[model samples]
Target: MSEDWTRLSAAIRTARKARGWTQHQLAEKAGIGFSTVQRLEGGAPFTRRPPSLDRIERALGWQLGSADAVLAGGDPEPTGSVDAAAPREAGDIGAPPAKRLPRRIEHELASGEVLDTEVLQLGNSRVRMIIVATFEPGDGDDQEAVAEDLEAWTRVQHQLRNMTPSEGNP
Candidate 1:
């Protein structure tokens, strides 16, 4: 086993005991079998199949590197920032911060122009002309408000029969 396993398992046992829970309790909490905890504490090979790391973490109120993983040599963290590992600064140990790079955002807007289109539907011998209604924004407002309105005004075209409607009658 890796040297880290012994250290990690000891850490697990320490954390569990600090909470005043028994091996069975820790097993139940970590979602692993009772023997798993016992083996880990005794530095023996794990007797139970591995459980979900997420569940185990939740049970221990910790973020992985637990007893079973240590005993079974199941957890092997890479030599860099582990994904979702809590971040740290210089002179700070372990993973780094969770701050992500700023995302590029773009705002697009369409003017108050009613768009019309023609569509042909197959299987029913139906031809359709579609009209989409829109409204231009008032002057003197920030582009954001107009952009919001434009976003809200993008409606689907109505399905219409061939040719424009004249007077009444279907």
Candidate 2:
């Protein structure tokens, strides 16, 4: 096996173990398939569009460029010793913190309402909204009730869409 591959695989294994996470947990946290985690931990050849090293780094909470260095045959310093109290470098003073993607927001329509909405932020500036409403079964099937429910759902969807900022705006 190539030295770089072996080093990278070992680093991944060590980092996962340090967090007391199983392969399945790591895969879930990384938003990747369990089998992919297995292959990576098993040191299988990284073929067929392997997951991005950046994704794995984010999932593992390692400092940026740590995985890249391992894959490039360089030893990376452990991330646990980062000196938060240290002064920032001159060039990095104004650098913004990295944004974590794929956030989720959930809220209810009213204090006691059975309707709830969840917003999932997909990467690359895309988002999906899901609305859920619950109702107790009626005495019998009621067409009018069904139609009312549909109308309420449609109105909620429209309101949510309008609340979202337009693409043209910042």
Q: Encode model 1's per-residue lDDT on 1-170: one tens digit a residue.
A: 34444555676677667767777666655445667667666644334334433333445565434444555555433334222322223233211122221111111114354423345353333433333444555678797986766555433322234344455533
Clashes of 1: 3
Error of 1 at 26 (Å): 0.8
Clashing pairs counted in every model: 3, 0
At residue 147, what lDDT does model 2 achieve? 82
- Candidate 2 structure quality by residue, lDDT tens digits, 1-170: 34466677898898888777887666656656667677777766564325345556666766656766777787665556322223334454322223443222122323234544546443345445445565555678589987887698778777765674558662
Clashing pairs in 1: 87-96, 87-97, 88-96
Return model 2's CA RMSD, one decimal: 17.2
**Candidate 1 accuracy as lDDT:** 0.47
Candidate 2: worst 10 consecutive residues by lDDT? 102-111
